[model samples]
Target chain A: MELSLFDVVGPVMIGPSSSHTAGAARLARVARQIAGDFVRVSFGLHGSFAKTGWGHGTDRALVAGALGLTERDERLRDSFEMAKAAGLEYDFYTADLDVPHENAVKMTFFSADGGRLDVVGASLGGGRIVITRIGEYPAEVTADAPTLVIVQKDRKGMVSQVSQILAAHDINIGVMRLSRTARGEVACCVIETDGELPDGVLGEVRSVPGVLSARSVSV
Target chain B: MYSCFADVERLCAERGIEPVQLFVENEMRLTGRTEREVYDRMDARLTIMEDAANRALSGPLGSVGGLIDGLAQAQWRYAQGARTLCGAFLNRVMARALSCSEVNASMGRICAAPTAGSCGILPAVLLTMQEQYALPRRSVLDALLTASGFGAVVMKNATVAGAEGGCQAECGVAGAMAAAAAVQLRGGSLAQMLSAFSLVLVNCMGLVCDPVAGLVQVPCAQRNASQAVGALLAADMALSGQLFPIPADQVVEAMARVGRQLPIELKETAQGGIAATRRGREIAREILHRERA
Candidate 1:
């Protein structure tokens, strides 16, 4: 996407370092969207995020994001207390992850309803982030636009089916990535759209043949 | 593409339009947003910048690192005192710069003019200009759009990331952006605005981004204050018809070249410059220990 004047001038974020704080918060916020509602989340910091994330308030920012706070929320500073009040369990660990980026984190989230998810993302500075992985699938989700993540059985015409549904709804696809473990096995399709997916699009997608689960995320 | 100041100048000359007009139209074309929408968005950003610039003056803000707290309030008090060196306007400018940076360090909300680390400089100059001159909101917003134009050129030709180009990219470009905006706010000509932009880049070239403890405190906040002052001085020189030997686009390219030559240690790694000092190491260790505890 072309960089706008607004992109140059502002994200209007809670800050100290854009990469460590604002970007970290955004990465976690996107992770939350991908993972859905979670009662507990653990952040595994890597490289610079592990080295100086504490001082830069990456931990607090990450926690705030897990609680669904936007980067501009002033409650970011007191996010730990807010998390406590919200009954959101959180933990931070310095982990050795073989990520290319210095500002990376691996997050695992658990819900009281026995749902679990794993997301790994990196802060690419200036409050930008790329979610590199979701669950066991390698992914590239930037959250720059509204996105749909679909888990499905690797089968013929799955992409065409999803694209047709989106086309039927007048949602234009900007970028799409499809990955799978092996032929006819489980696969993940991540599609970023130019227009918002109207209500019931997810239901329509989930009802597609061989589709396992689907979620829509916007940031 | 608005790739350079020379292009901006040539276009303005060809069309006999102001830089803000060109910028606003370009934004409209690029984003498919109306002029009013663009202006309203910028006004919202201005509101954010204003809030961040003023928040720390009312009370001390504690930083997450425990490295910088109450410094902006202290500067505010000093600015308010009977005896100070920078006079009332510049002192408050410095204080507001510090205030925004302090708010940033404390994880308060702020607009990242280019990057969060240098968020203070532009808002400090623009807000102080508005306050001192009672400038119209339209004028301040125009100045902001003008600044973003210059910043976009820098981003196109070079960068604004400290990790990629050191503090020169973050704070230096921010100072240049602020200087250009200040020149516009003062009704200076396009040449003067470009001159101010070039002067700031020349003055702040090769500045490193070695935040102590790898945190955006200590030197970062002070650098914002000093660069805010530098931006004002650059604008003053430009408005007075002073010119640089090198053109603004070349200056931005030079900054990019110098930034590329900077070692990784000096580029936000916290492994060189002040971050490498013995005391800096001690502070890092202490902060880490405290956090672990």
Candidate 2:
């Protein structure tokens, strides 16, 4: 991604370190969006996030994010207290992800409606983050982009059909990745676009012949 | 992204405006926001910087690990004494910087002017100037934009990551940004601002990123605070007609090269420098044991 002036001068956030704190918050925020109405979140912090995260407020930063707070929210200092008031149940565990990236976290979100999602993300320095995994699927998507995330039955023409819809809408695809747990069983497709998805694009994707679910997260 | 500083300088010259307009335009293109949106957003960040620094100066807080705290108060005491080495203005710069750094160490909210570890430099310098000289808030924001312009240039040309380049990339670049902004805020021309920016980078080049115990406290906070003084001195020298000789772009490249020459142990690994010392290791272990509980 081209570096912006704000990327250099801003990302105004609560911080002792941008990666450990701000990016961690961002990871949790995305996880929050993925797992709607989550009641319980088990955070498996890895490497540097597990070792020194306590001192850097990574723990609280994650809690604030799950509560739908931005990094700049001044009430971030009261996240722990506010979380309790909001009736959110969460836990933290030290994780070993077999990865070298120092700032990593695995979040398991349990929604009140009996949905469970597991996400692994890394804070790639400077408050930028990548959602590296979703459930049993290996995926790569950045929060900096307007993205379409789809989980579907793995079969022929799934990639082509999805691109056709996006191309039809004049939405330029910046990046697209198709990763399946195994061939012809289940797959995840993450599309990052140059323009915002036109309204109702998610419904069109969901109505596709073989898609299990579709969601678009706007930047 | 811009490849070098000369490109930025040339763009600014052709536009017949300060480097700040370059930053504003670039921000608009990159973020797709209007000029009002960009400046207003920056104004909000500027407000946060001042608020965090002021909170720190109003009272000191113990760092989370308790390594450095109350030093701002001690500095204030020394500044109150007769025949101090630096005057009250410089003392306030240090105090403001220390306050923000110390606040950051305590996990208080602060702007990551470039990064959190070096957040204090620009704020300390600008907020101090805002109070001492009564510069308009808009002008302060413009200085911040001037700082941001060079900041983007350096981040693009080289590396700003301590793990990639060392303290020279983090605090070093921050000092340069602060110096350039200070020059702009004080009515210096673009040439003087660039010279000051180069001078600060030239001075801070090759500084290691060996924070004790992999924490952003200790040397990090102190560096953030002291570099404000370094920035002011650079700005003063540039304003007094001193030249930095090397162009800003080459200086950034030199800093990047020097960073690669630094050993990994010194690049935020906590395995060398003060972090390898007995006290440093002890502190790390103690903090780890406590956190586990």
Top lDDT model? 1
The C-alpha RMSD in Å for every predicted model, in order, reads 1.6, 2.9
lDDT of 2 by residue, B1-293 (tens): 35577777777788797778877877788788999998898888888888777666655675667776776766666666776788888887887778778777877788887888888889989988988898998999899887888888888788888888888798888989999999998888888998999998888888888888678887987898778899999999999999789998889889999989999998988888788989989998898777677
Model 1: per-residue Cα lDDT over A18-117, one tens digit each: 8888888888888888887789999999998988788888999999888888888888889999999989999988898877998999999998999889
Candidate 1 residues lying further than 4 Å off, grouped into runs, are A113-115
lDDT of 1 by residue, B1-293 (tens): 46678889999999999898988899999989999999999999999999989999888877767676887788888888889988888989988998998888888889998988999999999999999999999999999999998898888889999888998899999999999999988889999999999998898899999988888887999999999999999999999999877888889899999999999999988999999999999998888788789
Q: What share of the true interface contacts does candidate 1 keep?
A: 0.81
- Cα deviation at B5, candidate 2, in Å, is 1.9
Number of the top TM-score candidate: 1
Interface root-mean-square deviation for each candidate? 1.8, 2.4
| Docking level for model 2 | medium
DockQ of each: 0.70, 0.58
- Which stretches of model 2 miss by more than 4 angstroms? A77-81, A111-115, A155-176, A193-209, A216-219, B73-83
Pairs in steric clash, model 1:
none
